[model samples]
Structure formats: C-alpha cells, structure tokens
Target chain A: MSLQRLAIAACLLPGLVACVNSTVDQMVFNTPGAGIGDASVVILGRRHASDYETEPEFIRCVGNHISSRDKSIGVVGEQEFLDALYPWFEPRTAPLRPADLERLLEHRDVARAFTTMQTRYMIWIDGSTVRNDSAGSMTCGIGPGGAGCFGFGTWSNDANYEATIWDFSKRAEVGRISTTASGQSYMPAVVVPIPIIAPVQGTACDSIGDQLLEFLSAEY
Target chain B: MSGSMTIGPDRWLAATLLVFLLAGCGTKQVLVQSEFPPPVMNKLPLTIGVWYDEEFANHEFFDEAAGRAETSWLVNTGQAQVQLWDTLLKGMFRDVVYMNGKPGPGQMNPVVDAVLLPAVDELQYAIPAHTNVKVYEIWMRYRLQLVTTGGAPIADWTMPAYGKTPTAFMQSDEGAVRLAAIVALRDAGAHFASTFTSIPDVAQWLASLPRAGDAARRRVQP
Candidate 1:
C-alpha cells in the first residue's frame, strides 16, 4: 500500500474502533403537553430484595444533572426523599404498579408529607450496569519500592436502565425513558499496565437525565 | 447446471403464504361474558361498601411476542365478582356502594355499616404445547376481607376456583381460554354467595346488627 493510503487508514482506524467500542441506545416517551413548571421532582432508585438503597453515585449524578439543566424546578435530594418516605418503605419495590401509588397516597400522612415536600412528580430508576464477556488476564508483582503489573486484559461492560415518570396530581404515568449502554475497556502494558475504565453508569445516567428533562419540558 | 438458479412464481407464492401463516399465529384478545343469576334479598338490612385492590381490578395478561394484551382477568374476576356480590346481597342489604378506587379519610359513605375488600391473589391459564386435543385450564384465587368503617377487620377468607374445557374444532385457543375463565369465575361467585351467610362468624356478625324493629324505633324517635 502507498504511504498516503496507509496514513489515511491509520487516521480512520481509531474512529472506527472507537465507534465499535461504545454504544448508547435510548427510547423516550414524551407527553406532548406535560411541563415540569415549579413543582419539585424526586429521583429514586426503586428498592430491590438485595439492596435497600439505590446507588449513591447514580442518584447524586442524576440529581445534579437534572438540577443543573432545569432551573425552574427543584430537585429533591436523596436524603430528604428517603427520610420523608421511610415510613412507606415496606411496599416500595421494583415494577411498582399504578395501584401501589394509589394505595400509598390513600394514607393521609403520606399525602401530607409529600405535599409538604412540594413533590409533584416522581422518577423511578431501575436496573444496573455490570461487567461481562471478560477476556485475557493480568498479574501484578510488588517490589520493595513499588508495585507494577505487566500483562494485557480486556473486558466489556453493559448498562441497562429504565426511568419511569409519574405525575402525582394526575395519578398516572406520564412518560418513560429506557437506555442501554455497552462498551469495552482495555489494559495493555510493557512494564506497567494502564487500565481504561468504561463509564457505563455515567453514560446511562446522563442519557436518562437528559431525556427526562426533555420529556418533562415538552409542551404537551 | 446451478439447479434452477432462476426464481419461479411458485417459490414466491410459497414464501408469501408462509409469512401470512406466521403472522396469523399472533396472540388475540378474547372477551368473556357470563349470565349472572338474578339478585336475591339478604337476611340482614345493613348497607355495605365494596373496595377492590387497584392492581387486581385492572390486571391484564400481555403476550410479549404479539405486543398486545391477550387476556383481561379483571373483566371476569374483578368486575364480575363485584356485580355478583351486589346481586346476591341485594334484598338482604340496605344498599351496596362500589368504591372504584382508594378512598381518602371521610370519603367513604357514612351510611354504610361495613366495607368489603376483594383482592385477586392468583390467576393463570395453561395449555400444553404439541397437544392435539387442545385442552385449556384456568385457575383463580381471591382473598375477601370484611372490615368495619373504623378499619377493624371482621372476617377474611381465601377462595380458589378452577375450570377446564376442550377446544372445539375451528375454535381459537383464545376463545377456549376465555370460556374456561368464565366458567371458573361463575363457579367461584356461586360458591362464595352460597356459603357467605352460612359461615359461623359471618352469620354471627350479621345477627349482631340492629334489628328492623330497633332501627324503625330509632328513626321514629329521631
């Protein structure tokens, strides 16, 4: 091959490789006339049987993103939401049906607490990100002065998440956003291996948060 | 010779027919209707309020492959049960109030003496694959609770009902399932109504209510 052709190939290869390494798939259900207005929105990670609290990092990231993007609405902090909703924790679970909310709101105390918090909308985030399809291996040796690893390793990560928005005033689900992110990470070393981390959770949070803002802000 | 490399009209026709057949196999919604028995008068004249669990009241089974709701058990199990209860207890009770959704404090009718809450516990239908006979079976379980207006539970019971039917020639699987579900719901309603007033605790509670003579006296005095 000519030097020019090889140079062009070298330039294009990284772009192609990068594209193959990362993927983001998103679906948004926007309510045409729904607006967030001045109501407060709370983002919660639906509790599962294994975990009592949602990932702190994910909650904080989403809260920060939403608060930063939309200045008109107030974002309820994780601690405040948890503290207010602690009394009704037993019935809060994944795949919450519409009836569950109705039942919960039937309690005067619950309604009063939520009203006091000025929370009119709830965003329920569920699902997780995990490492998968790991290949290759690495080993490290420690010397008196320091420690160093000399090996190559590669792994893929997948993030699957869904966010459901519920309007308390309407007593119905207004919209939903589902996102999937997958990427590969690599570590190569001649003497010391530098690891590349796949920001799967961060990507998922960003995608979901941005779409949520769009759905909430749409003039439907 | 490349063994008839040119496509023929017959091959294209065969492919189109296969596609149509596959598409026709998608799930279909089935509506089930039943003829309920006429209303009967209750022995007791106390008014009752009926409340249904939201999930159970609007429950539907989805066929993911077809991307549609295939069956609505709520039709037969939730609405039907409420209707039957109203009918069977009509004469014996003063009035029956149907609370469609959760009621807040002071939202309930003050005239009603007690409330009846029904929740669907389990609902399922099964049909074995690769079966020539084409038999469908349906099962339903309901939990019934009777409570006072003050939220004091009076009585509760769980009832299970089942029905099975064979698919007729040229009949759809969805139709067979619907028929089976109807049969199960009918049997469940009948059994519940028949034995409701006979239960020792329930009968005792009914007997404790104000008698017609006493009620008339109180009204007259007031």
Candidate 2:
C-alpha cells in the first residue's frame, strides 16, 4: 500500500508543480524625482484597439493596488481621468505623439482642462494577460436528478504588461515598467473535479503595483 | 476477477481526480522597471510653426458596420500620425511653435522663420480574412507644405509611408496594425527630414536666413 501511494504521488507531482509554480520578471526605468512633493498621478489603461475590451481587470487591479500601497502620492481614479479628457476619447483619433502633446498643452481649453485635474504625471498601462496552451479536458454529465462534472484538464496563462510613466510637467516619458509572467494551471477530478486556478492577473497587478510604489517612492 | 476490475476503475478515478485538483495554475502580471533613455536633441537652431487642419485633427474614424468609432484602427493611426509628425519635427528642429491655423497672410507668427502645414491626404490599411501567414499593411500619405512667415512658399511635397507586419496564431491583429502604422510613420518622417534639407527651395530659404551671431550682435548693439 505504501508503494502504491508512492506511485500515485509520482503521477500527481507534475500537476502539483503546475498549481504552485509562478514567476515574475520586471524591469524599471528612471524613477520619479523625490522633490515633486505631494503631486498626484493618474493611472490609465490604453483604450486603443481591443485593449479596453480585454484588460480592464488587470488595469483596475494595478490602480487599486498602487493606491492602497502608497500614501504619499495621490491616485486618480480611471473615471476621473476619462472625465477630464472627455471628447478626446474618440476612437478614430491616433495616440497622442510628443508633438501632439505639446500642441495639446498649448491649446487654451485643453491646457485649462488638464490644469484643473491637478495631475502631475500620467501612468499608461498597456498590454494583457490571457490563457494560453490549454491542454487536457474534463467531462460533465447530468443524471435523472443531478449533474456533476468529472474530468482532468490543464492550461497555462501568459501575462504581459508595460506601464509607461509620462511626466505632464516635463511633457515626456520619464519611466517605464514592463513585466511578463507565465505559469501553468490544472484541473483534476475523481468523482468530483477539483479546480486549481492560477491567479495570473491578480499576481501581475500585485507585482506591478509593488514595483510602481518602489519606483515612485523616494525611499526606494 | 470482478473485485480486481472494480479496484482498477477506482484507482483510475482517484488518479484523475488528483490530477484535476492539482492543475489550473497560471502566472500573474509581473513588473520590471528600468531607466528610460534621455530625449534626443537637434543640432540645427531652426524654429518653425506647425499646424494641422482643425477638422482633420479632431476627426475620428467611424466603423459603419460596428456602429462604433472606437474600434477603428485607422482613427488611432491617423491620430498617431499627427503626433508622430510633431514628435519627429520637434527632434529635428530647435523650436516648434504650434499655430492654430494655416500660415496664410498675417497668420504666421513674427518670431518663427517658417511654417509647416501637414494635412492627412489618406490613412488606410489592408488585412484580408481567411489567409494563412497573416500580413497587415498600413498606408499613410501626407501633404507637407513649408512656407515663410511672409507667405513665400519654400517647399511642398507629398510623402507616403508604408508599414507591414505579420501576424501568427497568438498575435493580436490590433497590435499588428498599430505597430505597422508606427513603422510607416517613422519611415515617412525620416524620409521627409533627410530629403527636406536637400531640396533646392528649402536649401535656398534656409541659406538666406541671417546668422545667429549677426542677429544677436544687432540686437545687442542696437
């Protein structure tokens, strides 16, 4: 019986590894100066293309995490940022280039609008985390009175994100934080299936948010 | 024999269940931060007024079928082109003074030596469906005109830029298009800058401008 248990444990080792294994890779660019005292920054998710449709959770998660972690720098909510940039959200227009930014700042109304927001910096988060390389499957069936799912399946997720920090005062990109996380997930079943889900998006948010705080804070 | 068979099925079911319980793991978002490169500066001390058509500047590309202006890649591309022109020109020129309107008579600023007007003639892309080895091609065309503040035409040229990128199984079509547009615009901008200085009309106009020292001396002595 002990030998049999050992064999079963060997069979399940890979799945166990899949459930617990996760890796985070990050790179930091220039850090914001410490002297900018009490100036607020807004975190925005780029809405171009299908980004708005796919990456809201990750965006919101990062924003929430950053706000919760750092007490010194104020965080602007996503809706407030959008409200300040109203009418500029038209999907047909191109992403603002550096020159367009200068032009925008020069415009009386637009300048006044941004000035009213009192945001010194803008952090644009772009990219997505998605499920990839899914293999194996489980089957579900319904009986006369009840239904249950039984089967085995496994999948992996890939998370890629880049946070670009734009200094509104300087009208330039001051820093960038980019990260990629990839890990495996599995679902196993006997009579009742047990799903071992990977918190890929959540992990990304935490990692990014922590690093962002480190990058923005004077201590780090 | 029946007991042995029942044991075999039971073991298999348990193994399957173990596997299911152990699976379903994924990576979360990780962030890596690094120092960004410093901004590049231009050597030439030239200040030009930049302007774009108001209608074109605010125009959004609308998708009639989707009934949404937001999904159109062309819109972003168009907007990106305007920004690209501004960025590239700023890097090439010492000062870029943005003007609200075309530099017509009395519309030009007295401080600027010349004015540059960039108008979008066409912005488009092609990505056909149901094809292997997906190819996205973005075409951008611009009408660039340079005129002196006094309304004398210096040079006028029509520039076209093209960007092409491939898509595989996992790549996003939107990302491919955006990248292609960026590539096309960068190419077009580089071509324009490299060729603009060589144009006879532009060369003559630039050559005619007084030297900085001469102007400074006059200012100081006067």
Candidate 3:
C-alpha cells in the first residue's frame, strides 16, 4: 500500500474494529528556543509502585511511534539506557525529581554519561491500564459429540498515563503531558466466540507520542 | 452434600497423583545470577581488604514447605553474590585486595586500611499459588561489616532488597525467580552505593582520612 493508503487505513481501522477515545493535555513551564538536534531523548517507564507497573511495551510503543513519525528525533532505547546507568535508574533508586538529577550528575561517571549519551530530554512515564466493569462471560466445554463455547462477554478498559519531561541541560522539568483513554470490548459466542477488542492503551500511547514529537521537533 | 467426603485407597491414589502433578514434584535446581553495572561514583580514598568465607562463597538455599519428598526448590546464589559484590566494591574503593585466612590487622599477608565482609543474612521467595495475581517475588537481607585490621568493628550495616516480576503471564517458574533475584541484587547494589556513607561509623572513619584534593569527587592522591 502507498503511504496515503496506509494513512487512510490507519485512520479508519478503529472505526471498523472498536471504539477508542483519548485526550491529551500538556503544561509547558520552559520551552527550548532551539529544537532538539543531535541530543537524545530517553523515555523510561516508572515501575516503583507497590501494586502496579508501567508496561515496557507501552514505553516502546510510544518511542517507536515518535521515531517513526520523525526520523531526526534521537530516541534512546529504554533498556540500553537503564543498563548503562544500571542500579542508579532501577525502580527503587531512580531520582524522583529534577533536583535529584542534579545530585546524580554530581557523580563523575554519571556526568560522563550525560555527555556521552548526549541526553538532553528525559521523559519519565508513569501509569497503567486497568480493566473493570466486566458484565458478561463465555463458557466452553467438550461433550460426547463436539466441543464449543457459548456466551456473550464485555469489559471496559481505561488507560491513563502522565509523562514528565526533564531537560537535562537545564536540570529542571520543562513540562508534563498526560493522556487518558477508555474503551469497551465485546465477545459474542453462538458456537465460536468473536472478540471485538479495543486498543485503549495503544490510543493513549499514540496521543502522548504525537504531543511529544510536536513539543520537541515541530516549530511552535 | 457435605464438603468433607470419605476417602479410600482409590481417592488417596488420585489425590497423591494430582498433588504431584500440580507441584511439579521432586527437586528443581535453579542458579540465580546477574550482570552488575559499574556504579557512577568517585572511589573512596581507601584500600580495603575483602574476605569471602567458604560458606558465603558456596551458599545456596533449599525451600520446602511441602515436606521432604514433595515440592523443593534449590537456589544457588553464592557465585553471583561474590561476583556482584566484587564488582561493586571495586567501584566504591580506590584499591581492593583479597584477604586469605581471615587475618587481623596485626600480621596479614596483604595489609589494607580496613577489612570488609559481606554475607546474606536471610533470603525468601514466593510464587503465584491459589491467587489471581500471577506474580513472583523475592526478598533478601544482607549483613555487611567493616572492621579494622585487628578485627575491631568499624561499621555493621544490614540492608534489605526486594524484587518481583512485573507480569508473570507466560514465564516459567524458574525463569521468573531468576529475574526477580537479579532485580533484588541490583536493588541492593543501588542502596549500597547511595547509602554507604550515611552509616555513622563509616562517616566517622571517612572523616579521619586526610583531604583527598577535591572532597566532592573523593579522589585519592596517587
């Protein structure tokens, strides 16, 4: 398919399959006069919470989306960055604020990494997708003659996430972007079950990715 | 119908078979290892001696809550711990020397400022069972002692670390445990790097050392 057809198909995919609605909000404290050039952006998923963790797939989804949209944007791989820094950026030890980043830069090796990676923007993403309000169920069993599932099922999923952008050169949070998305999925079984699954998390990731690309690459 | 039903030879045989299948019966040996990254810190201005005792070097734990013949998990952590601590200590100190025979300051082959000892005080692990949450968790506590050459204690630090799989949907039991252990080890390293100087005795010992050019960098003179 041509780029135009691909774009058209992407636009119409959700309408044909499932419904996903998402909203993006951004607050800019300080904007860089010059856009990000050679400097890299590291998007890390926050995994410190006791009960839940931000999925790694979601972080990669956001990174891939932004990089695909704009090739010039230097988006560092999450695991590579984490391993290079190792214990410093682990779940329990990561700096909670930009001031903490200042403290981390005090270390000689960490400072060297800042220069080596040319990391200018640090995006910390924290949130998770949750499923609730499931109202139906499908039952499957095997009898003497044949085996099949029969029932109707539905559930609601909500994906809410917030991304804090830290300008490493300035040692302060420049802005934050948050996305909220929710969708309902259904499954109906006469003999075989058909699922109309919603991609709420993907919708949220794309929403945040677009806003981030515009923030870092597009002329405002 | 009563929930408690009578059991006979056939039912007993069936229950035993079912339990064996569910538990993945017998012994499972697992090796827990991790690749430690170099800490980003200026080395302390001290040459420390590290002694890895025999038991500490070959430590492994066997977990058996279902009696001796049933489910048993044998996890070996000695080699990984030694490698991790060795790498970590190298990052934290200017020079490190291995000690032989647990020698005191009076007559040691390779003499240093102080001797360091690290041991696992306790370790515990859990896997998803009879629950909706598919999670694997591990917890470890470490005992670290910094002592003078004469064996007088300088600082005794005990710290805890924890790790768990984010989602254990399709991972095997052994794989999940190994991953969690790696996370816990990294957590311990992070804590040690960031919190070592905060110990009162260690702070005092560090204060005793003469100025090493820039105090912020903690760089020792050659």
Candidate 4:
C-alpha cells in the first residue's frame, strides 16, 4: 500500500521543466529622411561597410572626446554618415515586372532612405566594426595617481548603429530604435575610470526619424 | 548571652533567605519561531541549440529592385541571426533557443530563445560554492535564422560561444541595481571588452523562503 501511494504521488508532480527567460534587451528603430527642399530625401540605417571591422578604434575614440571639439565634430559626422543612408524596403507590387522595379526604386520614401545629404559626399567610417580589436581596454590610465589619465582613450569610445524600418500608414517609416555605446563603462579593467565616455546607436525607429530629418534637409 | 544572640541572628537569616526564594523564578528565552522554511531546489532539465541561415534582413537591400515591398512583413529566420555562429558543433543543447524562424508581431530584433533553468544535462550548469547568494552558470550553444511562413529563408547570421555562456550575470534579481549595472557594463564593454565589470553584492541578496501552513501542528509533541 505504501509503495502504491508513493507511485501515485510521483505521477502527480508537474515533471521537471526549467524555462529561462531571454536576457538580451533590444529596441526597434527606423532611419529617417534627409536633404534640402522638395527633393523628397529619406535617410535609412545601414550597417557600416563589411570592412567596418577595420575602422580605427583610436581615431573613433578621439572623436568622442567632449572636451575636444575635433572629436565631438567627428562623432557628429559619423552619426551624420549613418543618417544619410536611406532605409531598406521591399516593393509590394508582386509579379516580375520592370515597371514595378522602377517604381520601387522611385518610391520617394524608399529613394530618400538610401541617398546621402548631397550627391558628392564622403563616409569617414568606411571600415567595418566601429573600433579596433583591442579598443575597449583603455579605461585605466598608465598608473595610479596618473596625470591627464586617459583611461578609455580615443579607441575606447566608439559607437555603432544597426537598424531596420517599416513604413507607417502616414507615408512615413516607424519602427523601434535600439542603441548601444562603448566607453570606459564598457571596460572590464580595475580602477573604474570616472566620467565615462562611449559611442552609441539610437533605436531603429528613432534613428529613422533622425534620418528623415537629414534626408529632408538635403533634398528640399 | 553571646550564644543566644548568635542563634537569634541565624533564625533571622533563615527567614530572609526563605522569603527571597519565594519571590524568585527562572528567566525565559522567548525564541519566537519564524513561519518560513529554507528554499528548496526544483531541478528542471531543458535542451537548447542554434539555427543557421543564408541571409540577414538587410540582404533584401542587396537587390533593392527585388527587395522593396509595402506589405506588413516580419523577417524570415535566415536574415535574423549574427555571423559568429557558423562554427559551432551541431547538436541539440538544453536551455537555449536561437531565433531560427519568423518572429511574431511586436517581437524585438536579435531574436532569442527562451531560458531553460535547472537543466537537463549535468554538464550544462555549475553552481560554485557561495559564488553569490543565488548565482548559477549555464553553458549551451545555438544558431540563429529567420524563415518565412511558407518555409522560405529570409535572413541569416550565426553567433557561437565556446566553453562559457556567451553572456554572463543575466536574469539576476537585483531590481534597480541590475538596470544600473547593465547601463554601466554596456559602456564599459564598448570601450574595452576586457574592462567590462560587474560584482555581485552578497549582503543584500534576497530570496523569498517557503512558509509552513500549520506551525502548531509541526511542533514535536513533548
């Protein structure tokens, strides 16, 4: 009788199952449009070039220095470069037709999403991946009581952007924006440096909005 | 006369002692027993793994003519993952779910699998002694991709980690502390992957303990 009772209790249990929740936090975003008047410019988010990994972290880091006007301007340019690309989209008109393809490319929102502020433009961060391979290690200065401690030096502060966009009913692109930045706060070294500096990407949707502003400025 | 006085003093002393004894009682230790019990382990076994794909979402832009569309769309599995995963051993791991197919609406990007706790395999998790008030290590690998509803590949990318969990100190119960720590760590990792740091605080760790329904019934009958 006792053996039978034990078996019955075992069968009643819910069975062992562990469900771990996802830990990766994410945000959605869309790139906006940019250009001067009436040209109907759009700005889209695009990953840096495949070789973006080759970007110099130190140079990018130098650009993040708030005290250094040069660095600040450089970061602005990096953001601006990203802001210039138009968002990517697939055409809805089904069936293989040349007209559909032309219309797709000609779609004002779609066209504006990819073009830069001006026809003759440049991209400073042509390399893939924003910073150097060992970029994140500069948080601690040379030694204790160090003067002009450059923990999280130029290479330590770099930002990258990855985004997607979906068209809104209002003839605009709306989506989530996800942003991530790198700096001293991202470092794993001891002697946590103060006044952390880093690079960041906005949400996909918010970035789209920013891009829209850039595209409209360039086109109109 | 002296002998009588001594006897009288002895009698008086005995009377005082008797009165003091009558007024005395032992002090009590008032051990107010609590109602809760220590936490118990509910072991659960789970498996995890990765999915592979050929394209990522943006690949649609590679041929803008073929990629532009107006329909409300979700990315297919292949376009969904990162590239680091192309190299892991192909096997079913417990506790990890890689994004391998289309995501549901309102789902965030960089799709992830659900977490598996306790664990199916003994080799999957390790709990170091006093590592933290509630710290556990989980090891598993997965591939990521997105697939359309009709079974077409959409995007592809793979990420794989060896030996240790790709991300650590995840899903902690540190409340506001956890959020602040993540922000700080994100910045640190950006500058130097090696310098990213977080230390668990043991003093303030809290877990809700189990409580008994009937304390009076549990007391050992004397």
Q: Best candidate per lDDT, number?
A: 3
By lDDT, is 1 or 4 better? 1
lDDT of 3 by residue, B1-222 (tens): 668868887677688779978666567777987778777677887788998888789878888757644468888889888888899889888899998757565655477878888888999987766234545778899999998777889899899988876563476878888888888888888888778877778877777756642362354211
Q: Candidate 3 — which residues are off by over 4 angstroms?
A: A1-17, A135-153, A188-193, B1-23, B26-29, B66-73, B104-109, B126-135, B210-222
Docking class of predicted structure 4: incorrect
Stretches off by above 4 angstroms in model 4 are A1-35, A38-40, A47-129, A133-192, A195-220, B1-222
Which stretches in model 1 have alpha-carbon errors above 4 Å?
Answer: A1-34, A49-54, A90-95, A144-146, A218-220, B1-222
For each candidate, give its TM-score against the true structure.
0.44, 0.46, 0.81, 0.19
* Best-to-worst lDDT order: 3, 1, 2, 4
Shift of residue A13 alpha carbon in model 3, Å: 14
Writing each residue's lDDT as its tens digit, candidate 3 over A1-220 gives 8999977865764455579889899998876666798899999999888667788889999999888888888899998898788667998889898888877766778788879999999999999888889998789986547778999999998999999999998888999999999999988776666677888998999999988887888553
TM-score, model 2 to reference: 0.46
Candidate 2: tens digits of C-alpha lDDT, residues A78-184:
75565454323222322355345674453354577677767787788877766778888778885546777877898887777888777778777777777777778
DockQ for all models, in order?
A: 0.01, 0.02, 0.36, 0.01
- The DockQ value obtained for model 3 is 0.36
Identify the superior model by lDDT, candidate 1 or candidate 2: 1
lDDT of each: 0.62, 0.61, 0.82, 0.27
Instruction: Please report, as a value between 0 and 1, the fraction of native contacts recovered by candidate 3.
Output: 0.61
lDDT of 2 at A144: 48
